[model samples]
Target: MTISATIDGQLVQWRDSKRYLWLMGAIIPLIPMAMWGLYALTGSTLSWYFGPFFVYVLIPTFDLLAGLDPNNPPEELIEAIEEDRYYRWVTYAFLPLQLVGLIWGAYLLGGGTLPGIEDPLTVVQKIGLATGLGMVAGIGINTAHELGHKKEHMERWFARVALAQTFYGHFYIEHNRGHHVRVATPEDPASSRLGETLWEFLPRTVSGSFKSAWGLEKKRLNRLGKGPVTLKNDLFNAWSFSVVLWGGLMIAFGWEILPYLVIQAVLGIFLLESVNYLEHYGMKRQRLESGRYERVSPAHSWNSNNIGTNVLLYHLQRHSDHHANPTRRYQALRDFKEAPVLPTGYAGMMVLTWIPQVWRKVMDKKVLDHYDGDVSLANVHPRTAHKYGASLEGAAA
Candidate 1:
């Protein structure tokens, strides 16, 4: 059932499910809320694990059931979809749920009342509870990523607030200024190199990103004649918000609550990083004779059009369009035929990336295929290029 109309003088079409898209947004909050409710009613420690379970377990199963959606909206409607306030408001309305979920989960674990939860929960129980809350915090990063890219003033600030829930506020400065500029090149810390395992990439990215963010911020402040000591420094201000958040949790809950908050926030941060690793795993920009890399294009980042996960992620899997045009709102981002693609959505891929052998087995062939078997066209990490053996000569270049 498709219908067509004119909006602001542009043709618009409503597809089978697009008209009811707002309802899909509830999946973000409802799944975790339901899991928490189950834990409260039954007092089963195992119930606390359901949040991550639902994501890593159930979502991937559903992905198999729902299959891919290759139908992109008509090009003419891109502008109309962007102009529609419905999509923007859906992203905005999600902000409160993130804040409430964070606070509510903290209360559940911090000896606050619930039917079956005991005062002073076991350390094991606390960890389980934190794991669930961490999934919510990870989704907060997704929320921040969607909003932070917008040019609007208030939406940008709200992006920072959403990121602060996971103590990842610096993502605003680094992702926009640093990663976007250096992505797919050897210089970008966020992009995983050939043969690098998630374990190896994690520490490097986690530490390097902070360093990159600070350096980027410092340069900006320097241009304005400000220093780290000044409140005008954006990095300092963003991190200050995170510090205040951590301190607030300790005050509102207890000193004991601090550890759970820290663990949960780290889990959220790791989840975002894991996604980064897969997005550009073995790809790189070609360096030109003039000593500059070729301009970023759709080929640089991996794309996934898995319908169910794309909806859940607000179409973040459309990475090719995003890197090529950072300002394009998520709804307007399109999948390109030339873009490299993942075998599955992010949830399933996240699990695969943890096992280095399986990840390489699945993705290495795709990397070679994307560049027509020429390792020179790919970003082969110097240490592992020899294994691809035939292309080693050119790959070293």
Candidate 2:
């Protein structure tokens, strides 16, 4: 049976392994909401705490708190890129939750309907909420990362909306065509240099991706002979959309409430950028004779396969295979023997990235191994000889 078939438990006339992954990836957003829903339904303070703590503390800790070790037992599933149906599905399921969260957040900001808790979860509840928002921030971008790569207009549009919610929409463009292509080299601003710290990477990634989105879109627009993407383009629209959307919320609620939104979005983007800082930390693409970077190989990006996070996150942590084959679904993306493996999952790696020196100290050796120092324009976008092209027959190019 095909990988996606195993996940969806059904066949497809024109499907690969992505059905389950896409289906699952869309579900991550609903988790916190489900928790919130239970709290709402139960009308209990403890219930409120349950949702946040699990999302914030428990789920994120699978990799970080555990120190990212997954004891080997079952290699029962090794998903690949094309089977991202699960990944995409989770994302789809999660979106309505985002809207609900936004509405709830707006309500809280507006002082409309935030029910008073009975004090059972006063402290833990707060921590859970914070962590929940943090996860929202983190997962928001990760979703954008996945959606941004799709060729569908709806996918790209949803990705933009998600990014805008987090105030990091530029990632949609810069990541898909820019960073993933030029990563590990000086050309890509998102990828941290060998000696760079995570702190230094933050502003650069934030600003660079934003501006590069314009450039990337411009390339596409120019290719199609379109006008400037100032207002009509989704990239720029994210900025305007958020301004009005949040502004309306502030007017409805209070300006003070805006801080929560900003903080959460900032934290979320940081969560993602920190991960970007980790992936390809010391790796660079090889130059080929045609003046392009070599094929998207396992060596180009880092990989991690903590079972819990891998399954929960829709295998995003196994990035090497995803980058190696951009169109591959997340479910089918797997750990390749040749690719480098991180010691922990994304959450753990993210925590590790906070301490720049410590992160460098830990990952220094791994980075050095894949450093391709002598790259030039003579070697960019290297020809990929692998058979990834055959998989693009159905959904998109």
TM-score of each: 0.93, 0.72
TM-score of predicted structure 2: 0.72
312-382: candidate 1 lDDT, tens digit per residue: 77888999888987877777778899898898898899999879999999999999898888777777766
The regions of model 1 sitting more than 4 angstroms off are 1-16, 19-22, 30-32, 118-120, 390-397
Q: What's model 2's lDDT at 196?
A: 64
What is the C-alpha RMSD, rounded to one decimal, of candidate 1?
Answer: 2.5
Q: Please tell me which predicted candidate would have the highest lDDT against the true structure.
A: 1
Candidates' lDDT values, in order?
A: 0.80, 0.61
| Model 2 lDDT at residue 281 | 67
Cα error, candidate 1, residue 79 (Å): 1.7
Cα lDDT tens digits for candidate 2, 1-397: 3432243564423233334433544455555465567777886646544533554456567555434422221123433333435446666666667666765655544445444433333444434454556567577777677777777788877777676667776676678778777776657877765556788778877888877888888877777778755566757776765777677777776775666677667767777887788777645565579988666677767778665566556668778767776765555565677787887776667667778778867776565444433222111222211112212221011
**How high a TM-score does candidate 1 get?**
0.93
